[model samples]
Target: MADIEVTSTCEEGYTVESVINGEWELVVDALSNDGPSANEVLAADYASCYIPAFRVAADKHGYDDVGNIEVDVEADLDEDDDLVSIAFDMSVEEDLGDDEQDIVELGEDICHVHSALREELHADIAIESGV
Candidate 1:
């Protein structure tokens, strides 16, 4: 497996700048200026990753041109203030047969991000901060 690394920098405030492969930069900030909050970022990332999975699933079922699939992901914090659960509603611009909806749902399992979150896969989390 290839090792991928991204770097992020932030000041005391909410804005964060992330560099991907030392090439691309994305600025994620609090929603004050209509920027993306951390919660919003997670929702967007999951949805973005799911779209390709949906497309691939549609193709596998011998149906192309499913059109752009729109995924809406909503997440909420649990009692302990941890982001724990996500609910999604999707819409495919084109019409699929009655049974084809199941195929689309099956494709959702293909997204690694979605799968990891859904299954609550363990992660080695490390934090370094001055107290």
Candidate 2:
């Protein structure tokens, strides 16, 4: 059996409803005027995966209480609306000081979504201390 499975169906227009692992449901609109588009969902998934990986990386770097982290994901698209690049602006509650870059590297290494995305699509991260 496959480790991951998702079944998606579209009854009308560009909106699709998907069932993941036969338990979770997701709704995506290709145009995204009514709801989140596919690219938006992918951005969210990357952020979600990154947060925990970042926390683990912080811990491994011997810094406790990294605190609340907020990630703003931005995707650049081409004329055909194909993704060209992604960037992450992260705000954290704790100051990482000199170890920030190392922690970021470790988090990127650990995040599954980071591994899944193409090298060109890898997020250019900027972290700000406070908030």
Candidate 3:
């Protein structure tokens, strides 16, 4: 078993900063038109996670050196500006292209981020208020 954690702070409106391993990793300003929104983070993370998983799946299928596979992840939001759906698209390098569907399935099965997404988003709320 392995453990991972990231700290997110939203001290300024919709802007959030994520820190990992005591280093500032990502800064997202949801209120800014040019910055990445929360959903964008999800999409990017999905693709980032899947890319490695894809490599693993390909290796498992006896494919060596899958080359550089391009991936695009998109998030669709409703009129309320809430994340409603996520879509993943990728172009596998010809050198390792085989059973794409199986690769996707295996990738999702192995990717930790994919696993977290597959599981329901449940949080055990903890509150600390000082007034």
Candidate 4:
């Protein structure tokens, strides 16, 4: 296995400063009142993971000209148990001559983030829309 590290600092309520390396910095904010909770982190992670997976799936299905894949991830928090559930709806504009269905199916199947979240975090997930 390889090692990866990211550093994060909290400035104020529900907002965090994150750096993957010394060069890049990102400010992340949480939507809920509680602020930059684990829910927001989970949502970001899901979004990041799904896009790349979809790209790989697209390429495998001969979508050589696949462009501008968009993924929206939402994490809903359960007040009772304090669990966060995630969902992803992704769309990609591709011009695959005869492999559109294959590309879509492959993209859906290769969404490892969804499976990992379901298994690791027991998240309730719905792939609401895809194309």
Candidate 5:
């Protein structure tokens, strides 16, 4: 059996509905004008995974909490609309000072999505602390 499974179906145009683990559902529209495009969903998923991974990294680095973290993901597409690059603008409610880079690195190491993405698409991250 697979460790994870997702079933996606489309009855009509660009819209697709996905059932995850047979419990949760997600809807996406490829046109994006109707709903979120596949790229947008991928960005959201990266952010969701990175946020908690960052917190866990902070904890491992000896900080109990990093406080309300936010991430703004930017994805660039080439002429063919193929994803070319990704960037992350991250902000935290607490000051991490010099330990920030280490935490970010560890977070990337911990995030499954980060590992899953192509090497060229690994995010260029900028973090703002105490914001």
Candidate 6:
């Protein structure tokens, strides 16, 4: 398992932190008193998984110029219960010739993170779109 450690500091009215061994930098609001909750962690995991999957899918379908891809993941938590549901959505800009379906299919097939999460945590996932 991969391990990460974060050290946060209050700077400019925000909690700025650097995640050790992580590629992206994160900044949180200090005044909100809400940071890096369980749902946020889940969403970050899902989003991180999607980046490589999307890149591989685009390359396999001959989309050599797959631009930046953005993924949005949401986890719904029950207020009075312990059930959690996750939803994933993504937007990718690529230059492919009549192979959009193939790219999308590849992405769906390689999204192993969601499958692993479902098995480990018995969570429900709602996939709005593959691409």
- Give the C-alpha miss distance for residue 9 in model 1, angstroms: 1.0
Best by TM-score: 5
In the range 1-131, model 4's lDDT, one tens digit per residue, is 23545789976666777877556766666654444555666677767766776678777766555677666666665665354555556566665545555655565567666666555453333332224
The whole-model lDDT of each prediction reads 0.65, 0.92, 0.66, 0.61, 0.92, 0.59
For model 4, the superposed segments whose C-alpha errors exceed 4 Å read 9-16, 28-37, 95-131
Q: Kindly report which residue stretches of model 2 are placed more than 4 angstroms away from their true locations once superposed.
A: none
Residue range 6-111, candidate 5, lDDT tens digits: 9999999999999999999998998886679999899889989999999999999898977799899999988887889899999999899999999999999999
- Mind giving the per-residue lDDT tens digits that candidate 6 earns over 1-131? 54766655555545456555556666554343546644565568766875687678877766666776766666676875333776556566654546655665676568776556654342233232324
| Model 6 TM-score relative to the real fold | 0.56
RMSD per model, one decimal: 10.6, 1.2, 11.8, 4.8, 1.1, 6.1
lDDT of 5 at 82: 84
For model 1, the run of ten residues with the poorest summed lDDT:
122-131
Question: In candidate 6, which residue ranges exceed 4 Å CA deviation?
Answer: 1-34, 80-83, 95-98, 119-131
In the range 5-116, model 1's lDDT, one tens digit per residue, is 6899887587888888888887888744536777677777877877787678777877766766656566776776467766666677666666455665656667767676
Cα TM-score of candidate 5: 0.95
TM-score of each: 0.74, 0.94, 0.76, 0.58, 0.95, 0.56
Candidate 3: stretches off by over 4 Å: 95-98, 118-131
lDDT of 2 by residue, 1-131 (tens): 89889999999899999999999999999999667999989999999999999999999999778989999999988998888999999998988888899999999999999999999999999998655
Q: Residue-wise lDDT of candidate 3 within 50-81, one digit each (tens)?
A: 77987898778777666767765656778887
Would you list the rank order by TM-score, best first?
5, 2, 3, 1, 4, 6
Instruction: For model 2, state the Cα shift of residue 39 in Å.
Output: 0.7
Candidate 4 whole-model C-alpha lDDT, 0 to 1: 0.61
Clashes (backbone N, CA, C under 3 Å), per candidate, total: 0, 0, 0, 1, 0, 0
Error of 1 at 131 (Å): 54
Give per-residue lDDT, candidate 4, residue 77: 54
66 in model 2: Cα distance from truth in Å? 0.8
